[model samples]
Target chain A: MIAIDFLGAIGRLFLGFLQAIGTLSVFTANAVSHCVRPPFYFRSIGQQMLVIGYFSLPVVGLTAVFTGMVLALQIYEGSSRFNAESAVATIVVIGITRELGPVLAGLMVAGRVGAAMAAEIGTMRVTEQIDALTTLATNPFKYLVAPRLIAGTLMLPVLVLVADIIGVFGGYIIGTSKLGFNPATYLRNTADFLEAIDVITGLVKAAAFGFIVALMGCYHGYSSKGGAQGVGAATTNAVVSASILILAADYLITELFFSK
Target chain B: MAVDTRIPKVSLRDVHVAFGPKKVLQGFDLDVMPGESVVVIGGSGTGKSVMLKCLLGLVTPDRGSVKIDGQEVVGISDREREPILQKFGMLFQYAALFDSLSVWENVAFGLTQAKGMTREEAKPIALKKLAQVGLGADVAELSPAELSGGMKKRVGLARAIAIEPEIILFDEPTTGLDPIMGDVINDLIVACVKDLGATAISITHDMASARKIADRVAMLYQGKAIWQGPAATIDKSGNAYVDQFIHGRAEGPIQVEVRA
Candidate 1:
């Protein structure tokens, strides 16, 4: 009897997971369709872009710069042991543009923006504001989810682009100031080693990560039950899921693009 | 032959809904006439909100039919439901005002977004509605966060009525307010619905609110309307559940689940 109960629990868990995936998939399809449909809420979309993109600049910038500096220091220390200290500049540029910059920005924004969406929408859900939207003839997807999704997807790439520049510059600052390298050659090496595909791939990953962050946040919040505790849980779930999905998506995109 | 012209504005038949094994509604049925104010009363966890949500298409029933204005709405696509949805306005419990937007913006949201009215055009109407709800122009620029509970409820009411909907829904409209404030909101709801000649359905455990705003009272229990009658006769309702609820008695035919 105990064995049967254990098996049943396992079966229930599997079914629950599948159900979550199915619901999220449908939500994504609905949100995407709303994003493309006419009668767009331009002002709402613009406001969300400002919140998700413009406000995120400072955090994303700080993260990218610090990461770039640290990457430069680490590569210099490792390569110096093999008499290949010159590789530091090349490594720093590649690391920032191709990986660190986008991933760090994605994760930072996920923590900041994803949690906000979840909390805001979750509060709305518990407060019955979302249902109010429905009765007001406003589609929650169009008024709420679509704006955030578009803002997140469109804004993250721009953020990552700026982060890429700042990150490389961070590496340059550290190389010249701390690590005693020829400034002109370090800059040239940085430019020479960087490829367009590397930047493009990172940006594509950033966009996907942005979408994931918004999607997870909106899904959790919209479906949130009860009051304060439920909103809190949704906020935490949004950040965790967005971070995990970002890392996973980053790896997949990398494998698709760079792996032979 | 004379026509039977009095069709219900909203109708639900044998509706069933469940979350997992917890069935919230089983064969629930209700009919609401146009220009009628029907208040549904029940204890907590009695599926009152679920029934309201089902009527609004926010939650779909596992089985049964929902008809709005004599048109079948159950299982209809979102695009098809837009016109139907446009006929509604709702007042949420706790106000549910959007914290992100200023007071006027929240009130004007549906008008500008769903009706495609420019901000300039919608501003006067929003201001007018706010005044009607006993709020002044000074409060229009304030965020919802800055408002008192009563003020927030007023703003929420203004927003609800601004769209001039043919139907209005009120969800626990008196839940978080003092008795005086609750009475004020109840009065405003009655006035607004009467002014619009809209069909209204409200769900609340507040007897005072129900007595004040309801033209008729429906008692929901075990996923169905166990008793329904005119509000004037509530003091002598005679139904056990209704009596227990109105008197706040602990012992009745309605079971309150408690774990030992």
Candidate 2:
């Protein structure tokens, strides 16, 4: 009987997982299709871009700069034992552009923007506002979810680009100031070591991460139930799910881009 | 053709909806006439809101027929649902006004976004609708976040009526307001519906609001409307459930589940 109960629990858990995946996939398809469809809400999309991209600058910028500085110091410290301190610029630039910049930005935006979307949409759901939108001849997918998806997918790359630049410069600051490396040589090594592919790959990851952030936020919020407690749960779930997906997607994307 | 005038504006037949193991609606049926206001009153978990959601396609029934103006809406695609939805508007329990937009902008959203009217063309109309809800131009530019509950409901009503729709749904339109404020909202709903000559359906547990807004009153119990009559005769519904609910009694056929 205990074994039977254990098997039942496993089966229930498996089915629940499949059901969640199905629901999320359908939501993702609807949001993406509506985002690109003809009846576009241009003003709302532009507004979302400003909200997701422009407003995120200060946080993303600060994160990139600091990470770059830290990476430089760590690399210089570690490499000096092998008399390879000069490798600091190359490793910092590569690390920032290849992994750190996009992943950190995605996670940050997930916490900030993702949680906000979930809370806002969850509140709408519990409050009957979403139903009100439907009755008013407005599709919530088009009016609510599509704009965020578009903004998140498109703006993250731009944010990643800015982050990449700032991050590399941060490493440059540390390399020249703290490590006593020549500014010109550090700059040359950083630029020469970084390839367009590295930047492009980071931007691509950013786009995917952005999509995950918006999708998780909108999905959780849209499906939220109960009331204030439900909205609060949805907000927490959005941030956690988005952050996990960003990290997991980062690894998969990295494997895809660089695997033998 | 001769009896066509008697056809229901909205009709639900044998509708069944379940969320997991819990049955919210079980073979529920109701018909609402054009230019008539109908109210569904029930206990907290008795599916009053579910019935309205089923009619609106927000909650799709597992097995049922939902018809809007003699056309079946049960399995219709979004393209088909759009025109039908355009005929409706709703005032939610909490007003669900968009927090990012100013009061007038929220009212103008359906007009400009869905109806394709330019914002310039829609602003005057939005202002008129706002005025109809007793909201002056002073509150037009204020964000929904800045408004009190009563003011928010008024703005929600303004938004619902902005399109001059043929059907208007009020989902507990007076739930959160003070008694005096609730009465004011009730009066506004009556005036607005009468002016539009729209078919109206309101779901509420508030007997006073239901009595004030309804032309016909339906008492739903265990997912079905057990008794329905003209508003004047609700006091004489002759059903114990109706009596227990209307008089707000604790001891009744409807058992209140108390949990620690």
Angstrom error of the Cα, residue B125, model 1: value is 1.0
For model 1, name the residue pairs that clash. none
lDDT of 2: 0.91
In the range A99-193, model 1's lDDT, one tens digit per residue, is 99889999999999999999999999997778777887888898899999999999999999999999988888999999999999999898898
- Predicted model with the maximum TM-score: 2
- Per-candidate interface C-alpha RMSD? 1.2, 1.4
lDDT by residue for model 1 (B1-260), tens: 68547999999999999998999999988889999999999889989888888878889999999999999999999889989888888887788888778999999988987798989999999999999999999999999999998999889889989989898989899888999999999999999999999999999999999999999999988888898999999989889889999999989887787999
**Alpha-carbon lDDT of model 1:** 0.91
Question: How does model 2 score by TM-score?
Answer: 0.94
Model 2 error, position A49 (Å): 1.7
- The C-alpha RMSD of each candidate to the native structure, in angstroms, is 2.3, 2.2
TM-score of each: 0.94, 0.94
